[model samples]
Target: MAGSELTNIKSPRVKAARRLAKRAFRDRDRSFLAEGPQAVREALALEGVVAELFTTAEAELRHADILFAATHAGVPVFRVSGEVMSELAQTVTPQGLLAVCRFLHVPLEQAVTAGSRLVAVLAHVRDPGNAGTVLRSADAAGADSVVFTDASVDPYNGKCVRASAGSLFHLPVTVGTPAAQAVARLKESGLRVLAADGAGERTLDDVDLSGPTAWIFGNEAWGLPPELLRLADEVVKVPIYGRAESLNLATAAAVCLYASARSQRAGSESGPAPRLP
Candidate 1:
């Protein structure tokens, strides 16, 4: 299977890969596709993360290193055609490589307790790109984990996975948790839950983010509901000094998470307890 080209788009394996484009199929199979060399390479780096690897003939020659790594990891490497790769990939420009990966999400309790310093809870974020960007930002900020509430976009969606830029595999993530339940669990674990919204009474700069915290982000259009905001310990807003209307959800998340990260780092180095937010 490594050297042979799978040209037929209707091949059973090809069809199965294509079915991953649907949420129902991904849920049923508990598998998702990681396309492109970067995503595939990251998947292969983890033990048993990649179920299989698909490479086009031309791509196999160009990206032989990736294929070799996959094979070395004992993953089944199959050669596919350009047309077949395009059919299986979701991007406008196919990367000629793809991987079937097992579900990466962890249980809510497990993720909540993964490390407890900083967590990002997305309550009702509907956009897959935004959700993925937030996850990537969380990873960059050294957050402990990311929890996606039931109303949030599927983090395993192709667009979301691509937007994560391989961060999806780098952190502990819990999906399908209810917003209220997520907040309660984080609080029970002694983390301060700060709801990020435009109508918040307290500004982000006014809050002490050095303590363990869970930052909750809401939907793009409507933002967090009043009821949801009330569930949090406090509602915090990112101050806007410029003429720009509002920062997008991902940008806001990056700013808030990094602020917390900086505070935590500074506190640890100085041997002083971080102020509670």
Candidate 2:
């Protein structure tokens, strides 16, 4: 809306935005693409996060407030044709809006502090969608932070970013930290680490999650390895009441995180635990 339309996908600006689709380019540029109105809005809400915005004529008209906010914040805006939007957007159907935003990951040490009540650690989780869904769930459950270990998928992956549904901007995120190191630092911060595994000895119902807690979620296909499982204070399994096989990684994470959140909140209201007889 601020300048002439970008019709050519090969233009310098368009090319730069397209390059962000790859992890290498994103890392080198310290930016990634946020598609759809929700992602763009969330990115613009953060100071100095949105560098540039791209929108079709229809999108600009429909989301005038967003464009106005971007212009007010000194971010450049370009109107592009639907064809051009397709090239910039990853989805099968273009959302007609996209934004180039800075990376938002913090260091593990910064994310997990002394007062962290709930945290989610993604260990060797390869699927970007799953990782993003887990992050969204963590945010909903009032987690203090979300950590993507070195073996996990990139949090900036377009699929992951979109799957987060703008929750990526809601809480602290740590990327590329080794799982073991993350667990060690969380433990050092006084968090009781729990690993979510289907074959774990302890069930979620058995754990007292009133205190500070960090959950370690493993890969989808294969659960946490023995070494990683050993790092946790306890390995927990969500009890299966029905005939279902097992819950997916994202679903399991949501259940585990909410369990801790509910327990902690209830514990806070009920005073200290009664002494065991």
Candidate 1 residue lDDT tens string, 1-277: 4756899999999999899999999999999999998899888888888998888887888888888888888999888888898899999899899999999898878888735999999889999999999999999999889999999999999999999999999998998998888988999888999999998987777777778989999989888999998899999988888998788999999999998898888784443333355
Error of 1 at 41 (Å): 1.0
> Which candidate has the highest TM-score of all?
2
Count of residue pairs whose backbone atoms collide, per candidate: 0, 0
lDDT tens readout by residue for model 2, 1-277: 4567889999999999999999999999999999999999999999999989999999988988899999999999999999999999999988799999999899988999998999999999999999999999999999999999999999999999999999898899999999889999999999999999997876787778889999999999998999999889999999888999899999999999998889898875553334334
As a TM-score, model 1 comes out at 0.94
Best by lDDT: 2
**What is residue 79's positional error in candidate 1, in angstroms?**
0.6
- Candidate 1 segments whose C-alpha is farther than 4 A from its true place: 268-277
Cα lDDT, all candidates: 0.89, 0.92
